[model samples]
Target chain A: MFDSHGFHQTAMAELAVAAQVSVGQIYRLFKSKEDIIEALVHDDADQWCGEMAEIQMRMDAGELTIVETFEQLLLHTIDEKDEALSFDILAESFRNAAVADTIGTMCQRFRTYIRYFACAANDKLSGEALDAAEEMILACLFGLGHRSLSRPRLSASSAARLTAEMIVTALGGVR
Target chain B: MFDSHGFHQTAMAELAVAAQVSVGQIYRLFKSKEDIIEALVHDDADQWCGEMAEIQMRMDAGELTIVETFEQLLLHTIDEKDEALSFDILAESFRNAAVADTIGTMCQRFRTYIRYFACAANDKLSGEALDAAEEMILACLFGLGHRSLSRPRLSASSAARLTAEMIVTALGGVR
Candidate 1:
């Protein structure tokens, strides 16, 4: 419902109908729409963190190369469902402080995962260089999410692979 | 109003009041809110293209290095007003085909500007490598817009410089 109608436009009644639950039931489960959004954000973060953990383990075990793992991370940001809703909430975050805090927390968690990947990709990367690499990669992933709204020539996987290779090269080249 | 209240939530009357015009006058000027949005997008694109043209001219004159020009372009995407409104319309674009087309045109123009920068940054980059460099940089710029919502440790200048350097390195390194 949030994906199609946006957070503000989506009503509790509409969400109830979509979820196959009564409005009262929704109130019982979640205090308000903001609460629901917070829960959803946390749920999404947990899922992404779990996937990152698995990929991190793979990296540790030498099951995936640094570029491959970076590509995998970039690929995770391409889901249509998550992409639209994220833009929706992101706009809402501008008006709502609580939503901003929730989004900040989620972003912080995602950054931690990206930082770990950056470390594994280039041990020579440290301090400001490390932060820059992580932040640039973060921007790429977030920017890729916006690409679905635009027409791009490359397939998502191809785009992800190219982006990963670029970032890894940058990391390797950085002083 | 679209930046604060969103496209759907902002009424025609409210928009008229905000512009200090009567609702009927607004109707005379724009057929619908979507028309206003399309106009706004085109106006914004024109301004950006004008800026890019100026930068391109400077590049041709050898007044600025490739990384400096790239950083200047990246810095253009960081205005808070434009960033918020962009996210708002971007979410609306998911629901409105007309708005989507407007966004697509704007994106195409922006991509052209970035492509020129990519070519200038590395003469060897061509075909898929050139496209990849431009798209990756596009992602970084868009992602940087989103970073204002999150807390980024690096200042916009620092981030832009770091991102530009990284992408230029990748462009040079690409086979």
Candidate 2:
């Protein structure tokens, strides 16, 4: 209903009718329409955080390459069949400050993970080179994710590989 | 009203009050709230198109470099101060497939302009080199635009300069 009618169009009365209950029933469950939307947003965030945590654990165990970690992340974000809750939230973030704030926090958290992975992958780098490497990785991840939304046919695996190669190449040019 | 309360939150009665007329007056002026929003969007788009057309004319006349063209585009978008409109519409887009359709059309138009500018800037490029250069420019423009919303302090001029440098450096690598 939210997807079809939007946040404002899906009123309490309509929700009641759709759920086969009275408006009062909805009030008893959710304080307001905004509350329902907040709940949905929180649920989506939790799911994404869980996925990132799992990836981080695998990386910590030294079971995943930097390339494999990023490929999984991109595939998780852009694979057509996946439930892209983060992507959905990001698309709407431009409109909703709350959504933007949530996504920003998530991005920061992801950046830390990317930085750690980059350092792990290329242990020889430090200072400016490492920072530039981290920045390029983040940029590529963000760029690829944005492009995938518009061009769904772009292979997620290939995109991730290319992004990894580009970051390495770009970093090499920094010094 | 749409900036603060959002499209759905702004009641017809409030608009009528703000316009100093009866509720019927608003309906007479705009068939629906969506119509009002569309008008606003069209007006903003027209303004941007006008500015971009002027910039294109100057570039074609050899009065502006590719870097200058990019700077003008970025500065214009940032200076508009209609971030709210873009945000609101983007949020609405996720819910309405029609919004996505509109965005895709806009993207194609922008891509054409990018290609034109790129061709003019680097007349010697051909084949894969041309494709990569175009892709890099598009990515930089769109990626930086997306980032600008979160980092408003990052002036369009600076971003454009950085983007121009990055694209030139990337192309240099390819060469």
Top TM-score prediction, candidate number: 1
Residue-level lDDT of model 1, residues A19-109, one tens digit each, is: 9999999999999999998999899889988999999999889999999998888888765465557777787788889989988988898
Q: Write the per-residue lDDT of candidate 2 for residues A3-83, one digit (tens) a residue.
A: 655656667999999999999999999987656766776665577668877887897898876657766665565443222
Q: How large is the i-RMS for each model, in angstroms? A: 1.3, 4.7
lDDT tens digits by residue: candidate 1, B1-175: 8887777789999999989999999999999988998898899879889999999999889998988887887788754465557777787788889989988988898889888888887778888777778779888888876787668888888887887788788777788
lDDT tens digits by residue: candidate 2, B68-109:
776676555435454445556655655556655665556556
- Please give, as one word, the docking class of candidate 2: incorrect
Off by more than 4 A, model 1: none
* Cα-lDDT of candidate 2: 0.59
Residue pairs with backbone overlap in model 2: A95-B87
Q: What is the C-alpha lDDT of each candidate?
A: 0.83, 0.59
For model 2, state the Cα shift of residue A135 in Å. 7.1
